[model samples]
Target: MKRRTLLRATGGAVLGGSVGLAGCLDQFSDSESGDTDSHDFPADYETETFDGQTVPFAPLEDVAEWWENDEARFVDARTQVQYDEAHIEGAVFSPSPDGLESADPVAEWDTDTRIVTYCVCPIAQAGQRAATLLDNGYTDVYGLADGFNPWRENGYPVESNDGQASLSTYEIEGETDPADAGEYALAVHPETGQREASRIDADGGYELSLHFVDVPDSSLLELRTPSYELEGTIEEFSSATVQV
Candidate 1:
């Protein structure tokens, strides 16, 4: 949807005071500063509203500079399986859009911190969480524009937060691992340590996927190919066989 809301600053001299308001996100406490000055902040704040939440959304190219900064925190809004399969560097799994809005994960963060939320989609569930922060009085909130795809495409680091997921390769609640034998078949990625959930076999080629479900609803999946990582919503075991 085309956003019509104008993210203007009223309580301050200007909406955005400076280019480096990012520092304010890192160092200033939400209580330390009220919504008094929009100066030193991203100028004329504008955000794309998703799911009734207005998050600071910016293009991948625009916020690329933030990747190297230490003050930024990237939150993965996708499911645990997806996160275990792939995710951006320094990202934490909050699953805010999935109904964890008032959860402790967000509580761990100070209201004054600058958090960049993301998800798997053309748009993101993080938009809602970003808006939540703003509504709670957070001055700085941003949603990574292209979501996780841009980060991976840009060659940034990705990892599986498998530890945070409820399921693991060691124990398949339902479907059996069709990739390898024994423990290796149903095990975490040796390198990423993410649990392997599903595999793909197509025309003599095969791939694997680790679906993350605990993530916020603002995310989607980017299967690597004939292989996939499908998120299972039910407790019963589900299975699918693809012919190679």
Candidate 2:
């Protein structure tokens, strides 16, 4: 969605009054002066609409500029493991739906503050996180258009704990009871502190995506849903089908 909603002010002069609206004009001038210090995003950015929520998607190029200037708060929407492995430097690790928890730095930001969110899935998780911010009354929020993959691939600034470790994405999907629709599905690795969450679709299906960095085959993973939980090794979980 390459569109912008510009605010317009309409006014007319009253000829009969000799005294001008000086106080109101002064107040408006002060507000305008204050706004000049705040950062503004360009109008040509894209947007994504998911699950009835819409959020603007700013290209990595633009985001990089903001990052360099420290003009926006960067939020990593990936799991703790993914974030720990690699993330845009200085990014806050705040996963979606739970992003605004008191523990996250974003929780302390003002509603008018500029925020950018990103995930390895490119726009999927980032879009969700940005939408969540919009729902929470964040006026200026954007999703990193191509996400962390491109940023990392293009050699942008990033903080990595295990740069030599190979990163892999695994998608585990299965059906759930109809009653469990709208609930959350989570994949958790207790030892590594890796966790991923996805909302169960209305059709009783869900795909929980996990990003791992050199995860051991013997590592235990807990696949959990509102109705049931299954524990198995990482290899087992990669091929297992969750049914509840």
Report the Cα RMSD per candidate: 18.2, 17.7
Best-matching candidate per lDDT:
2
Candidate 1 C-alpha error for residue 33, in Å: 26
State residue 244's C-alpha deviation in candidate 1, in Å: 33
Off by over 4 Å in 1: 1-46, 51-53, 98-103, 162-244
Model 2, which residues run further than 4 Å from truth? 1-54, 68-70, 99-103, 107-110, 122-132, 135-137, 161-166, 178-182
TM-scores for every predicted model: 0.47, 0.63
Q: lDDT values of the candidates?
A: 0.43, 0.64
Worst 10 residues of 1 by lDDT: 15-24
For model 1, how does the per-residue alpha-carbon lDDT over 1-244 read when each residue is reduced to its tens digit? Answer: 3111222212222201110001111111111123323213455544554333445565566556676767667776654556565677777776644325456476677867777777643332455456556676766668776566667777877766455554221122222223311111121232322232222111222223233344322222211111222332212122333221
Q: Which digits, one per residue and each the tens of the lDDT, describe model 2 over residues 22-42?
A: 010111111111121123456
